[model samples]
Target: MTRSISLIPSGFPFLDKKWGGIYRGGSYLVIGPRKSGRTLLALQFASECAKSSEVCLYFTNMRPKDLMIQAASLNFDIQSYMNHNLLVVVRIASPSEIYDVPNPDDYLAEYLHDIVAVVNQYKPNRIVFDELTPYIGFRNIDYLNDVFLKTLEEVEDKNINSFFIIGEPATQKAQLIVDTLRHSVTGSILLKKKAEQLAGQFYGGTVIISPNVGHTEGQFTADYIIEPYKGISVEPTIMKTFTRNDSESEERLPELSKIFKPITKIKHENIDDMQMNFSNIYSIEDFHLIINNQIALFKSTGQEFHLVSLKLDSSAILKGLITLNQLKNSVGKSVQKKDKICIVENTILVLIAKTNAHLLNEIIKKIRINLPSRDEVYVKAVTEFIKIYTLEISNSFNNSAELIELILSEEATNAHLTLSELT
Candidate 1:
């Protein structure tokens, strides 16, 4: 009888077929930008390998509990593997020490010793080392070169398939390490965030594979999406070119609608993804339409609606998003079920229905006090960073567009208004 294919599935059909499955003694490097689903893809691969193999080992600086939480966020059942003895997770002391020892003098020896110890103990068929950047911290580039080659040899000697997850290179040294590691490894998978005018972004990315690995040759790239619910789904077509080309090049290409297939967009329904603390917020256009409907309803029912406009800085959007995500639960508790919250670029909008203007005033005041400020140590607290504007939707407007225009005009006016003036 013929032996079955020994390739292990990555749970991504196109990826599996392209590579002919991950084989034993193969080493791979998975590289991507921050928050670009690098960890998700690595864990997804590990989860699939564990299901079919005797053991798969995962090494990370994250605590086992935190790791599990992260896996759960991606809808992965990592705990099941842990329970079944099919997966072994080891947490290093700190990210910097992944390839460093307690003493800088003995760093390389200790680093290799730690890796050898884990591999010997687990004897795992598959192994994953997540995030190789911190380990490269302040270390001699040549020493790191030796460590990479040695680690590959050690894993290959044991005939174990291994994956090393590395963040996108931020410095010249990092790029060197990445290039060296990619060349040494049996294969390399590159993940990058792509915001295509054609493809709506919910972590849509491109994957490129190196030559002479998993039946793939001469380099190949495919577009894929790592969705919250669906996990990773590679698009039907191989990406011949990047969607984010220069304006000159973009202008020369065929019309986007004609050249590109419509990628599946993420629809965030009201209160989508119960597992997350934050709800599925709307965009400015969607928020405007809803406000228009609310105005008509207010005219017919004679009910009042309140709109709270919170302004933020474009430079601090990422920081603001993180702060808002952390405080979403607190904000949700303060608002009613009928209230709607949406972020429009640098502004956060909270629309409350069937509430008295006076009560909303009080709520707004409380929000001013409770909301976090970008500055903390100054003599006078600077809540001036976030400008808030409260508006009562008027029913006298002829149409939703008119009402929306008025609201937008007022929003612009409020940008110049100070918190002191409001108080």
Candidate 2:
């Protein structure tokens, strides 16, 4: 019996889309505007979860005792939950109290040490630190980022979820918090007002994420919702593209084919276009290694100058940049044929030779016949990889200084032929 396993956790669109399942294990941030009930929401969630014998720790930099008061207002049973020690409510003097005194950076260092120590000792499944903005204000957002990264290192499993709440008009400082945790936390929920209904009497709250609104135009969107609870109905729930699965993620979106056409070419540009001087004869260089090896055989053993470029499109090269070392080695005998050169235009190009060119070509023709219908398989892969592009460029382009170099490299691959300015 065999099965496919998803390394990603599913069902929660907001967190699932972002951290996949890491938030369940590590930490997360739930951010919204003032009076948006961010704290109330986090407490309600932590309390309700505590009932299931899940140990949680709610560390408050402000009023740890006021949790009962806040919970009472929200109709949450946090007091009873606190009584059983199922939840630990630690009231630090200030959010900054957890850190060292005098020097703000020193405070951050001490605060992170305390946090890690507490989390390790309790090993709680859920941890909620009421508001990080205050701490961030005392020190700096950059320092907070390091704290968050260190905090994530302590996270070991998924069933455990951490919620870090922040009140936001989305300040640069607050944005730094959002951006930092967006990476370290499992998922991020950006709460925004969709629109006002009944002349602004009621409004909708929307949750936007990066991967969900990610489209091919190199545009990533912030998707969310707006609602008045019972009065105003927001279409598509209030989710844009999130890491978690809210109630609305039940229905599946249409297949990739319905949205975008599949790409036939994976690498369209010639090496010359990549600034390689193919015109100038070179003896030994990394780019020419493959051709040089072949040319050497033809020179030393008097083999033919069999130079050929095979057009392997996206499907054939989806595994590009990712080495198929073992897979390629398995087919060594298949690819090593004398007096043969193949050109592939579509992705799945296989040329069989010695005497079976006719048969191989016939088989390939049949596969191409089914290409247009199955184009979506390629489109979806490329789409998800769109987010990974930054990582890919960093790994691939050594010459380029920043992400723009990678963008240019990918664009170079897409454009194939360039203008005089590039020259």
Candidate 3:
């Protein structure tokens, strides 16, 4: 009987698959902006490997301790792999601590020496160097390339697989990493923070891996939020498609969403995730702002508003933040008092909370009669929008409050609408 082994992706659609085939055995690198989530991404890949084999050497210089802590917190079962004699971890404070970068031959010799020693001693299937970039400095790109090419020559079919991480991309190294992966291993992945976007607010993004890892045929993205449903997880971004060589019945890619979170928490404290808290508001502005933010956050997390509620504080028409004429502009001319309504879409989205929702019935009674046809149409549309989305007008903060609280920060972050996005 002949034995056939096929590469099977974990089918974690919420991750990026830069390398089409898993890093079977060879040196690799991941480069991007600082705190761009390169380490976490590397850990995720390691965790995937830990599931199958033994001995995954995780060597690091910068944040080795923290990386282990984070992996442990995520409940990484490293000990099992350790017991299986499948993993080994080595840390180098800096390349100089281990080898001389000035001498290309020495650097390659050291890299090959240390890795082969670990593989020989432990017989691990994988070896990870988290801070490979520092070992090969900025002054010499060719030195890094030599280390990579020589390291690739060292990997064999029955030998250890490899992975590494780099930080703060420069055009040179980024290209080098890509070139090495193209010729050396199954693939490579890039982890980085997308630049912040200015839309009347300061925002920071979530971690992401390009599905198009090293020019391989795959793509994926995800956005995330701290929703009650998913504690502290990377939001699921949409994925394009996964490609494997022929004989692959189905292709699966890993991906995560890109999200822009608020810089401050001061304003976010007031916002909660329940539908009832904002159920009494009648202000179209607040409604638009809240709803819009929720949608964006959801998109960032790559999720839908499974539960939502919105209300208006029409007290403005009575107290005059908006006059009857302005109301007409919103609703329309054919509407009559107590009988008019309107619903405008493609605008802001906010979860409206008010001191009193019962009062709205009375306020609404007045519009039903005098509302013009246009105003009535808009009001009805808005009502229907709420209804269509399964949004409820809750009387209390009973169920689904945490889910609403989950999205509060996202809404408040961009609470004030930017004219650019609105236009």
Estimate candidate 3's RMSD in Å. 19.7
lDDT of 3 by residue, 111-195 (tens): 5456555556655666666655544442354655666566656654445566766554355544444454334554544443446
The order by descending TM-score is: 1, 3, 2
TM values, all candidates: 0.54, 0.43, 0.44
Q: After superposition, how far is residue 349 of candidate 1 from its true place, in Å?
A: 30
Best-fitting candidate, measured by lDDT? 1
lDDT of 1 by residue, 1-423 (tens): 443436667655656776676666778888777655678777877777776756888877654544554565445566566768787776654433333335442453355446767788778888887765545443465666677788778887887888888777665555665676677887777776676522343566677655334444345567887664345667776555322222433211011111111111111111112234445366667777887788878878887787766665432223222233423433455576578877654556788888886777666555555433321211012244446676677756655566445545755655545443454
Using TM-score as the yardstick, the better of models 1 and 3 is 1
lDDT (CA) for every model shown? 0.59, 0.41, 0.41
Q: Which lDDT tens digits does candidate 2 get at residues 337-364?
A: 3322212122111212222435433433
TM-score of structure candidate 2: 0.43
Best by TM-score: 1
